[model samples]
Target: MAAEAQGRAPDRGEGRPLRWRRRRSLGLTLLALGLMLLAGWGAFTVSVQRRTEQLRAESNHQLDLFAAAVQGMVRRLEPMPATVQLSTEVQALLRQPGDAARVQAASSYLRRLNAHLGGMQLFVQDQRGIVLAASDPALVGDDLSFRPYFLEALSGRVGRHFAIGVRDGVPGYYVSHPIHDGAKVVGVAVLKIGLEPVDEAWGMLGAPALLADSNQVVILSSRPEWTYTALAELPLERKVDLQVTRLYGDHRITRFPLQVDLRVDEDSQIVEGVLPAGLGASGAQGRSAASRGMLVLGRTLDGTDWRLLMFADLRPVRQQAAQDSLLAGVSAGFVLLLMLLVNQRRRIVQQKLQLNAELEEKVTARTQALSETNARLRKEVREREQAEHTLREAQDELVHAGKMAALGQLATGITHELTQPLGAIRTLSGNAVAFMQRGQLDAVSGNLAIMARLAEQMGAIIEPLKGFARKSKAQPQAARLATAVHNALFLYHQRIRNEQVTVHDATADSPLAAWCDPNRLEQVLINLIGNALDAMREQPQRALWIDAAAQDGRVALRVRDQGPGLDPALRDRVFEPFFSTKSAGGGLGLGLAISRDIAREAGGELEADNHPDGGACFTLWLPPVPHDAVP
Candidate 1:
């Protein structure tokens, strides 16, 4: 009995060992599966992170190239206009007492000047502010007293750049030279350079570039649509936030947000935010996560109301993290399959002892197939992530290209606008100098007063230019639509008279007002009026009718012109930048585009349609102003 009991104990003890072995094997399989998953997840996470960094680096590099190209183009074109003005001034001064013979001789000289200068327009004005001769004969005998350049030159300030304007019904610059006769003021020689040359010049400057006022208002851009926007309008802050949040601070990436202090350095440029540790992850949650990082590139232009900024976005690095997560899932599945195979082999081998070898072989084969499937999935995820990254880069490039093209058109428009006033000022100053030298103190003082008035006008014109060129700040205020329209009309009063375009203003007696920038509203009016004038340029009975009324708790201002009706096809795209029916060299195509944007930003709407009486009509709708507000 003792021997039998001992034998059973041995068998039981052996069974206990087998059970312990089976449990140990299961634990080992699970551990191996967990380790495999952990390793695979780790690798995927690392790979995704690395790829994200690479994509960000590539995006930044592309932005850098764009910035560099824009900088080069701006620098090159910066000095050309000033140089042309200086040369024209010198030549015009050489011809004095610009009488018929002298005027004829000046005309020949201007012709020669135009011939050599290539794309530059030249004209000569006498002391009486009459166009004695012009590179384009069509402008001869035209009175330029109402022009800003005429006023500026008559004031005696030299080498001052004027805001943009229209001359002889065309967009051009008017640079002047004082004709002096033995220290006596006699006449003014003027140059009217068409803006097409400037456009052509900007075209040569690769990449998109914008010449903006100190406030970051786009004065000119390769992209016309951008012209109406100030620096503040751009989602630069948002872009900075995105960059900091996604990229953190990867030195490999460029084009970060920056605060540029123009007063300190003309060539000042900086990248905003320091790179955070752990791929830009800040220790703090929301505070650091805001991602307020940016790259600011800037350059001052001839110490004027102009500055250039180049910026790019960096927010494509988050995709890498998704790839890593996917890889982790793949690795886990693979490990799970391996564990399942081991479990199946053990269960089958124990349950059916005869099939143990065959089942083991089958399990091994299934495990191999699972491994191959995992490998393929991992490859596909990597490939998909890469493709998405590439597509994003391509989209960014395309957007930037579109912006550049628009900026070029804007630059041309600005050049044309500024040239007219500058030319008038130059001629006026030259004549003023000649008069003072001739001992005509009375005339000099008179000219000075004219100059003062012109300066004031220039100041007024610059208000909008500054507003447009400077960064946008929310400066909403109660503005009277009637008063604003009157102010705008005052600026173009002389032009209206000159063009024989009658203006009929019938503003409602009730005070119509809205919260807006007065200067910006005035600009919208100017643009509308300017367009009206252009539309009536060929019309026999030219007229502009302005009617302001209060309706539906809104102030509506309508500007109707007697001219050729607008086409239905053009109406939809009339407000689109660079969409113009005028000749290529005729318009910058931004006036209406910017006007609409301004109107919308001010909670208003600008609409255009053919009037029932045969012409185009532009209506500006604004929210009603309060009854007790000051004008």
Candidate 2:
């Protein structure tokens, strides 16, 4: 009986050990599964992030290309309006809107020009915005005064706007330039380019494209249905404006149904929502097609107040991440199974070595792939940066070209100045020779002195140019304001006489001095005087007034011209680089801009305003030199 009880007790003890081993094995298996799931989740997250980043980079590149193409297309016709404004027939038409001969000639000229330009519409508008002549004669006498482009052009600026044609209903971009009869904006020359070419350009894009204006109104889009839609809600005032302008030709503006699901970056976003139907989709299919994850990217078009938007499918990125996660899970589960299958110490070590080898090979392959991708991305970035550097260099070269043109104009003035002196010197020498032959010693001597003085005057004129050409000193020196004004007037004495302009130099004897580079101060004075001369060229009463005063350690020199005072609207922009109110070839508009910069460099300022009596007045303020520092 004792032996039988002992055997049963041993069996029970063995059963307890067996049950504990089974429970321990189950816990280990469960832990392995959990570890596999964690690895898969981590892989999925990493893959999603990596792919999203790649998509963002790719979308941005695409957007850049798209914006550049659109800009190139738009700029192709920008010069046409300005060129047409210079046409004699067009100007004549503006001058005589009621003259049939003038209107017919202008229309014929525009017709030929429009045909030459290929698909661009040309028209002329009077200051009242009445179309006096057009390539399409039917458009003649059309009242387009309500158009935004017309209003902008009437204000003496190069105007740009996009809208549908009121008559033809065709979408087009309008570029308008003011036709100046002297200082007055007599009329406008308008060039309207049809969007058919731009629309045809969409064939190159694989995704949807949208171009929105400053008001967030989508003016151009790949999908026809999306056209004329607002990217956001329109303000009541804006709506009223669009209504009055008839910008879209009676097209009702509505908000596009697009919702941003996430912001990936400043210029990238994730969009998810059911937008309006695409090309041909309808009903349930249309909704399904529109309802999808999309990567939206945007960029501003250079040189215009327009934004471009593009979309890419996010399904591919999500799908790739899912596949990667599944692969990671399979790999981890296979490794766990191998570990469980091998129990012997030697076999366990061998299995671990094999698993590690597989993992290392996979990790090495992934790392190589990522490195290759990074290398490609870096190469692209470097290439883009290099391209940008080249563009900047080109811009600098253009600026230098403009400066050279300005120099040529100055040289022309210099030639005129020298011609007069040369002629006088030749006449004086001939007279001197006659006097010497006649035994008139005093007359000959007097002629010689006069000749010498003329030569010296010529030298004085040439000397300013030489100094202006030479590099300036590092620091400003004391300069006599009166002397600078005198030299500037001496350079333009011929023009002043030719134009019969009366000059009033209140500063000719002033004792004011300024702390500034002498050559630069002279240059500023020359520019101010030249501008004053130009302003009074067509005035009935041609007069210039120059004055100087000292106050609070500063000297203010003012140049006032009798011509139509600086257009009240253009007063603030007179000093902007390349913003010229002059006709083509008059100048690049850099004179005032350069003068302003020179003044600021010398610790001073330049400003423009209308004088109380009525004329354009430019004031140059410079740091005053102490009486003791005067040289």
Identify the candidate with maximal lDDT: 2
Tens digits of per-residue lDDT, candidate 2, 1-631, equal 9999987998998899899989998999899989899989998999988998898788777677776788888768788888877789987777778999999999999999999987568999988888999999989989999999999999988888887888888888898899898999999899998777678887566788777787788898887777788877799999999999988888899866563332324343322222322432334533444565666677776667677777677678879999999999999999888876665567767866879988788879999999999999999999999999999999999999999986885675456436655766787788889999999999999878867866776776555444434423336788888888986786577679889999999988888888987767877787888888888888889999999998767899999999888887878899986688888877667678767877887889999999989889999999987567764
List TM-score per model, in order. 0.37, 0.50
Q: After aligning candidate 1 to the native by TM-score, how far in Å is the CA of 12 from where it should be? A: 51
Candidate 1, residues 310-428: lDDT per residue as tens digits?
33222333345555656676777776777779988898667767777787898899999999999999999999999999999999999999888766655665664555445556666
Pairs with steric clashes in candidate 2 = none
Poorest 10 consecutive residues by lDDT, candidate 1: 247-256
Whole-model lDDT values for every prediction: 0.61, 0.80
